[model samples]
Target: MAEIAVLGAQGQLGRQFLAVLGRRARGLGRAELDLGDADAIERTLRRLRPQVVINAAAFNDVDGAELRRQQALAVNAEGPAELARLARTLGYRLVHFSTDYVFGGDRLRRPRRESDAPAPVNFYGYSKLLGEEAVLGAGAAALVVRVAHLYGGPSWSAGRANLVERFLARARAGQPLVITRGQTLNPTSVRDLVPAVLALLRRRSAGLYHLTGSGPCAAAEFAREACRHAGLCAKIQWISRDPRPARRARYTPLANQRWSQEGLPPMPHWRSSLAEYLLSAQNLPIRD
Candidate 1:
């Protein structure tokens, strides 16, 4: 068995983790491991007996979760809970990823700390919050990382692209982009996040932690920055409200306070990381 096992291997963050870990890790995609199947998860982990199990799989359709609550709960909440239990029984460390949507309806506009009380405004956030509680509540060595607006790596399964990629794609195609204005978050890159996660694993850090890019910005601002960095000019149509049915948190910038106190390396600012990502994304038709 490999030292590390990464679930959701086809995902943006999962792919990055596998690339970084190389031969030390074994990747399990949806066909090999289904998050909704508890018994299958147990059987797979028991057989693999990996020293570490990283659950990067999640039902991330924020708006779709409102319609498919059961699917969301099963994948996001119940799945992690089972993994946490197995980690204790199987003697493997578990690392679970969560989201910033776990914080909403907060009057405070600052970046949320690990100690902040979560008040998820949507079903997706609520489900992830339940997952975090379960993993941390289970008496196992687990690290629950809350990230926001992830934006590096290749397109995810089903051709779903990250925010930065979406913006760059549209800008390159000479299409006008319509983005929301009020919603804010720290646009984290999977490139930076994968290393930080490895560092946390090295430290054997347990419980909850917030890991994201340094700077926070609105969706429109993030899009504009992506275009600028890619050296593309495109018209942006900014709207004040989200047209989607699911409600989003207005200000949910996660602060890496605990990671900082642990003496981990600081994440780069969103702009710098965005610039680096655009430069590295050679497949995209990035203009000079």
Candidate 2:
């Protein structure tokens, strides 16, 4: 049994991590543990004393981050830095999650690698990249994982609706679902991500890795696929321009070269995982 402690335990990814850990782990939700509060985190860590601490908490509002840069930096950058410091001092392995927005490749087709130089275009991405640097710079045995567009399963209590659910809702209502066509990303399912994360943890791997679905797809394509998988009539409208304040990358498909190099099997493609998620009992809409 692995002694693991999951921060952001109620999040989509965090919930999946706990399910994988089962009785061997303890979870710390927002009320239980605030990443912004370094003293609180230290006290909780001292109490749990888990061998591995997974920091899944983040200020994930991409557009909102443009409005609240300080808050985003506090949670996304400073908090992780403190956690890394604690992990180093307390002798625990730290596993942190990052985003694909760290790269400035809007026109590039190839997926970004762990060794690629990070040049974030938005405040949110910059903050996440900073967090990753903080963890590694702290000199802790840390694994910094950068994942692509993520959607989760039935058991997720992420405190907000997922992309699939939001799309399904708009589709079922016969509403015109507008998705960005200009941006291309690999949509990774939490179903597949949990196992990949577990494999990395089992190896107790350190440094950076990219974990995402295999294919690069546009958001509109993803919406159409989700609607098709759910057997819903969708009126998906494609939009090349996003009016949002945050500057999103046009192409950010991540390649799991490091994961493969580490001898782990490749993850399923986005379509394959989307079909499985759409067919889940919780994801299905009630029939008239």
Q: Could you tell me the TM-score of candidate 1? A: 0.95
Report the lDDT of model 1 for residue 71: 99
Off by over 4 Å in 1: 156-158, 281-288
Report the C-alpha lDDT of model 1 over 9-107, residue by residue, as the tens digit: 988888889989999999999999999999999999999999999999999999999999999999999999999999999999999999999989748
TM-score of each: 0.95, 0.94
Clashing pairs for model 2 are none
- The residue-level lDDT of candidate 1 at 159 comes to 84
lDDT for 77 in candidate 2 is 94
In order, what lDDT does every prediction score? 0.89, 0.85
Clash count, candidate 2: 0
Q: Give the Å error, residue 61, model 1.
A: 1.1
For model 2, residues 27-53, the per-residue Cα lDDT tens digits are 889999988888898998888888999
